[model samples]
Target: MRQAYSYVRLSSKKQIQGYGQERQWEAIQMSALAHGWDLSDKTFSDLGVSGWKGANIETGALSQFLKCVEDGYVEKGSVLIVENVDRLSRAGVNRAVTLLMQLLDSGISIFTFTDNKLYEPNSPNPLMDLMGWALSAQRAFEESERKSQMILNAKAKAREEARTSGKIITRRCPSWMQVNANKTVFELLPERVDTVRKIFALYINGYGTPRIGRLLTEEGRKPLVGRAWYPRSLSRILQYRAVLGEYQPTLNGKAEGEPIKDYYPAIITEDQFNEAQAILHEGGAGQGRRGEDMRNYYAGLLRCSCGEGMHIVSSKVKGKRYYQMRCLQYRISCFGGSWNFNKFASFTLFALRRLPLLELMGSRDNGNIKQLNDKVIQLSSRLEDSRKQLENTINAIAELGLNELLQNKYKQLTSLIAETDSQLHAAKSALELSHGQVAIQKEDTQMLTGRLLELLANTKDVDSRIKLNQVLRRYLSKIELEADKTNELRYIRIYRKDGDLLVTAECSHRLNNALFYGSDGTTEAMELVRE
Candidate 1:
């Protein structure tokens, strides 16, 4: 007897729970029995898989069946039964017809229960059968296309409503928040909120995501949703603007609309968020996987004249270990030599102690603030242009209908608008923080400087060193080291965060003594004039 194989497909989980699968299987059994064909026990079924996108053929049971037929397991002249042509594929006319032709060419006959028709490998009227297949595939394509447009329209409407009114568009909020009964607002979960604040506090106090995760795990604190804390998950939480009460909707994994501010209750202030961003941007927090004893205090802040990081290199001479600061590109560069770590730290501290903190903090003129403001203006102008372009594209689509070029341009504009808006927000936040820095009181600045000095002087533990590194990054921009081979000295230039030269110093190569020089004539020792 001839053999028959059945293929069944349901587009969604809801359809699987319904009578779709059962109905398809019953029809296949009846057709097989009527034709006197031996029904195969192995059935190919794609449950909760989409046929419109051809996922069923690409990775689903249909793909497996095709492989089986190719391998001669299904045999020649075997019958393949499906509920309908659409059940096999709804990708489009050309693709669906191609799939049908492939099966027919392989000497397999297809029987559809919907039309009660059998399509043999060599039909007496091939053109009529091909037309029937085309018509069915076209209908499926149109139906799925219409449904997709409906979903897009619905999402657009929801986004508009969210912008006009403060409506919560999605229930997928931050881990610490939930949409209210009316969907007008998001209420904070008290316990989760506390966890978020604690995470931020630890990060601000010089803890990296890895260290924070370890600390939380040790304290018996669990993540809001997961069983254990992960560094990457914690990092994402720290970067979310939702914590600042902003909602940014996305479509197809790209930002869809303008971010709605105050959409949710603000968990952290803008200052706190911006401060954390600054630290993250600067790579201030030690990201090393070393134990509690961090080796490099100047992990991110120190640099060589060759524009490479200065990493610590340890060596033992006569069974005594000594640490030296070497350039990351030491093999490629021949201009500089290594400096003793202890002497370098002492010279840095000596210069910082007499840094004229009041004078530096009291000055209201900051180049960084001006640059940030300029960037904000540039990005704002770009964002406005992108929005106008997006509006014109939408108008064109409405008048001329959607084309591939117009659709691509629309996606590009939306993505550009989202990216520019994010940059603008960051610039504004940085500007705000810069302004705050200039307005610090003398007493607070004094206390902060004193505390920093104390921390730098007594960094005996790894945690203390890491905290000092993070804190130093907030005020100092970079510490550049250049070797003066002729004078047998190493020159150090310390720059403030505002891009101002704080002081310059020189240390003997022997690691014995050092001299400091200010912009003025003030000096701790003999001043060597630069040619």
Candidate 2:
């Protein structure tokens, strides 16, 4: 009996519970059992990994497997069972082909269930073995491409439907809404409908989204059967058009949906909604800090003894435009206040020295900046779309004379604009900040891979804590201060990059990564190609 290795893959969660991998495993095991392959050997498997991203076959996994074969871990000419060829690769198609050749050269036999084809290295016809794999892979490529196109087509259809019908076809909605049994249309939760009405009424009475949100929170407005109101939920309530009693105007010949009243119960009359919208569009009164949610690149990340976000707020501190941040919390209790940018930056520079190696997070490849251009374009477009939608809603409310609602919504929209602008400015400013990072990443990776790679290329010493700090702070986590002292010390909380706001929870993505590597984990690292 020959020892055999089995490989199987399922792309998503549904497939896992649906027995996709189980069926594949069973078929391969049955084949091995019937053929009398060695039953005593251990099984090798990668389960519930994607066929879309790197085929779960790249990223050192496949490399280790090939090394195993070369080391004679399995019998020569032994069978490798797979659910199908694509399980081996839906990515790196060319690499998969070359690897197949290598396996054949090593006298390995391949067996698959989808086509019931078998590869026998001893077979007289090399074409039979080669053609079976080549054709199956070709089919996989075609199918994947087809699915990609179909997804695009579906999204396009959704957008088209939205534009033509004056309806934003929601992919998701608030918890207080229930989808019809068919699961396409949505209706208000009867238990929570009054809360929705109150939200609209508050909004219609010149309360901004955030304030209205707070009122709901104070009221303990839990999702019908769930907990507190999420920001998204309050946001939705303030945005719903049914409160205005009409639909948005047809733009570019796309408006074709049933009018606003057809969707949900109206909370505010159209006229009231319009009046509210007008006040909002005109910017009646100031409320909330400008750009409160969007942290400045340096301000929030930098620290002072007080622990409040160091406010780099320009003020006439002896009549000069200066950037600074201070612990707002310290103002009343400890005379905590903002700091000048120059002093704060200098203090932070020393902190940077603690990191033995720093790499800017991104592709370190020469083409990375070019790759980032595409992302910039995509984010820009989405941001613009969001702005436009906000505008349309504001205008719709104004037209209906909902001044109070308009005022409230305008505040939210204004805040969103300010926040977005802040982030855009930070990204632009940090473009330079990332320079040292990119250089460090390149240096580290060069050691890892460039001719006779040194594994721990970035480490300066056994206890080089700051080296990890540089890369981790920028590329891995968004940070927040947890505690601060009058002295120059601070405690912090962290979240994933572009992840959520500063969470107080002790657990974090960074802590988990540490546990993964433990103490003995190899320190060799790859550099990002930020060129």
Candidate 3:
């Protein structure tokens, strides 16, 4: 007996949960019985996959059926049954026709059960068959296109309402929040809020995403979405400005309009959020997995005067272990002199402990901050003007029909809007850093300095060393080392995040000591430079 296989598709979760699949299967069975074909229990299903976008063909079970047909696993005389031609595809007329022809050319008879239509392998009325397929494809495409536009329109209306009324528009919100019964307000999930706050606290305390994830998992804390905490998810949570009660409207996955501040209940303070952003900007957080031991305390911040990273190398000679810091390009250039890692680390720690924290935090250029704020405002106005011009051009084109001048103007406005939007984003990021610097200056520097001194004293373990390195990066930008022509004296420069010089020192490898140099051409021995 000839064999028949059923194909079913439902484009949404709601459709999948309804009687769509069962109805299709029932029709397929009835058709197979009527034709005396053996209906195979193994059926292909693409549930909750979009046919309009060809997702069903790309990653769904329909792809597997195509593979089977191409490999000759399904016999030439076998039957392929679907509820309607749309179940096979709604990807538009050209693609739909191509798919229909491919299946028919494979010698598989397609039976669409909706109209009891059998598209035979070699139809006598080929033109009629083609017309029928084309019409069905066109209908499906039009319906899907109309539905998509309706959805876009509805979302635009909701966004407008949200902007004017400050009401929650959609059920989709942060994991820690939910829309109220009338969808006019958002309510926080207390448990998830606690988790979010904990994540930010852990990140500010110098724990990387992977480490934070592991810590949460070990403590048996349940994630809002998944069974276990993931590093990427934790990192995203730490970066979300939503915790600060801000909502950035997006269109087609890109930020669209101005951000709405104070849109949700703030989970963390602006200070805490700014601090976290500062750490992220310095590339301190989200360092993937680490080894059992951190070999260098100055992992990313240390570099040679030749603009190359100072990589660490370790070796064991007989019973003694030695560590050396060398330029990454030393073998090729030989310009960056090597230093004993232990002595260099000690000297750096000593100088950092005595540095004034308040001065470092307040070193940012107020002029630069003001310039960025002005740039943000100017770009925002330009973007609004360009968008309005684009909208007006679109209206003109609709009224007067397409012309060379209008088309050019539309393209120009589109390009201008994109460029201005990009500039606006960059300016906002710089402004965020300025705000973070201000927050840092407002902090209790005396207490912070005391904490720093304590942390600097406790770097014996790998975890402590890693934590201290990340913490120092929040304030200090980079440390550069150079050597005199003799290669005996190593000169080190410590720079704050604002690019201001914090300290300059010279180290003598022979004496295993360093001397701090003041800007007034005075030198103080390391022992005399007190905290």
Per-residue lDDT of candidate 1, residues 377-448 (tens digit): 999999999999999999999999999999999999999987998899788878866654443233235445
Candidate 2 local Cα displacement, residue 82, angstroms: 1.3
TM-score of each: 0.75, 0.41, 0.74
Name the runs in model 2 displaced over 4 angstroms: 11-22, 39-54, 58-78, 90-95, 98-109, 113-128, 147-174, 182-185, 200-215, 223-531
lDDT value, residue 499 of candidate 2: 56
**lDDT at position 148, candidate 1:** 94
lDDT of 3 by residue, 373-417 (tens): 999999999999998999999999999999999999999999999
Superior candidate under lDDT, 2 versus 3 = 3
- Candidate 2 per-residue C-alpha lDDT over 232-322 given as tens digits, one digit per residue, 9 for 90 to 100: 5665555556544433433346553324444433455544444344334334211233233222334224444444454546566667555
Q: Rank the candidates by lDDT, best first.
A: 1, 3, 2
Candidate 2 at 474: error in angstroms?
Answer: 36
